[model samples]
Target: MVTDETPMPVLFKKSFKKLPMWDFEDVYNQDAPLRPTTCAESLRNSEDESFRKAFLPNIRLFLHKDNINLTEWNRLSHFNNPFGFMEYKYADVMASVKLIPKPKEPLLLPKPGGDGCVRCAVVGTAGILNGSRMGKEIDAHDYVFRMNGAVLKGHEEHVGNRTSVYVHTSFSITTSLYLFKKYGYTSVPNDEGIKYVMIPEAIRDFNWLEGLLKGEKGAGPYHNKWPRTYYAGQYNESRFYVLHQDFLRYVRNRFLKSAILNSTHWAIVRPTNGAFALFLALHTCDTVSAYGFMTEDYNKYYNYYFEKGVKTKVVFYINHDYMLEKNMWKKLHNSKIIRLYQRTDSGTGTEKPK
Candidate 1:
């Protein structure tokens, strides 16, 4: 009964109430596997404020016509101004947004099955996974999430070949195709029944979204490019989702609030895309395992799993706080919120990945 009146923390509860499944296939192309309604289904009754308050589901997770109002727009605009900006008017963005299919509450699930939990794996492109042989383990989850420069051709042996959800912004998706071209990267992963989550970081994303949903000619980064052709595979409108601005701001304010946000460069500082992908799974899935994220020993490996150790250095940029991300991932892992993959070896671990 997730309705407009669903209380605060709608996603967290002692147990999830069941929902009718008239057209289950409309949500996912696969058979509905039974999953508990709440992500932490087993600990639904936990009274721990620290854990329960960490994720506030009452705030919209995905953008839909019904969920957003004038007030919500004004609130969200205080940050990156996702709905509108100087580049585009809010009314113009809504024209295309109106065409987007409104997903019902309890989205992207495979249908509840036998009170089982929905397990997910969020895979990053860090070099630590290059030789870890974690492909089999990563693909075993109910859903696999990947983002940014995720080149999985020959290295399928290490990084799993499946991608249930691909999270990206206009910049990441477009730049990845160009940057990873040498590593056999062709297009974004498009598995049957897969979902695409777009993070509208700026006005360009809205322009791209407009082009995508309305078949309009793209402006900005993809000027003159058809949004559909910009992608590599077939996409279904029903399966696509745009992340709500509240969720993005929530993650930054609560978990990974870096020191940079206080400085003049605060506008430029934000969590990595991988961080958003991981958090998305945390709020949506029953169980989450994070792979290829920054760890304490990040310096021991190359910047990206696909890059050669000698050829590229692990460049630390102002856009993201790598050290803060590493510590937060470690903290979350230690807190049992997520299972972060960390490799322990005997050597300095500078060995080239096979």
Candidate 2:
């Protein structure tokens, strides 16, 4: 017997979806004339097999002794031009992503002898977290991760007193470091900050810029800074797996390759900021909860809670497809895989399924 407490299974009708042919082709077969099964059966079987085989365990390639040979070789591929430019920049960009773990560093905070599920709270600077007295609830978790230009001072009474790691881009840090210091926002401790979660896209265009920010010869600008940095690698192989490059490629090849760039109602942000953070949490922690993402009523609040006033929807500048994100979130919510915080008008509390 199904009770009110039990969530009803959600079934998405294909008719309601607006995906194009190519997007469907990558995963679906609209021209399977030789198929002997129903469309649904064919889709399910094909998808099952593809998903299981998609992520290859090993891909070995020859590299030059000088390491410059591959870079020259990559410049020749069709992907090397526009798509090719993404490879290195993606690497540099990911290195700064905070949620990702350094190549082989030990877990920053091992529990009293290393026992217990690692608890992580990913905080976004949304109006939802504004006045809600969730600081205790948020701090109660073992580790906390804040992202972008997060301002934590004024909301302290409501948002609680816990900040383990801060993920930020060079742009965010450079432009706002003085404010963080001015507002009493200390750099998250080096031992605890897990710095460099967000990498700047500009740095990838110049080699000297990369050296300046990350090189260890001496402190350039961000070298040895708080929220220590890291680059992304295989899921189990690296300390953390960031989805920025991976997700950006997926959207480009899978969703936006054919569409006119920046022509749609929404722009798909590269490195999928929130999704990357969530992916890292999913891998790092046994359980995770995401708050302050774009909800159905997201237009009602400002981008950062620190700004007092209604949020005005700026035109989409990045590569994020918020509509697609909304659908994916709904599916995840229905599957009970993660919880999305529901904001109320009063900002006193958050709602989740019991």
The model with the greatest lDDT is 1
Model 2 poorest ten-residue lDDT run:
56-65
Write candidate 1's Cα lDDT for 209-302 as tens digits. 8788876777667777788865566577787888876677677767777886655565567788898898888767777899898888777777
- lDDT, candidates in the order shown: 0.70, 0.42
lDDT, residue 188, candidate 1: 89
The TM-scores of all predictions, comma-separated, are 0.82, 0.56
Looking at model 1, report the run of 10 residues with the lowest lDDT sum.
Answer: 20-29
lDDT of 2 by residue, 1-354 (tens): 333433222222222223223332223111112212222321113333433243211111111122222323222111221122323333342233322233332223334543544656777666666566667777787777766555666676556656555554445545555655554555432333343344333432223233333433212344444222322111132322222323233434443343333343212234345555654454345445666666676665655556554444523445556566656555455545456666645442232112
Clashes of each: 4, 21
lDDT of 2 at 72: 30
Residue 211 deviation, candidate 1, in Å? 0.5
Q: How well does candidate 2 match the true structure in TM-score terms? A: 0.56
Clashing pairs in 1: 34-112, 34-113, 35-113, 127-305
Residue 195 CA error for candidate 2 (Å)?
4.1
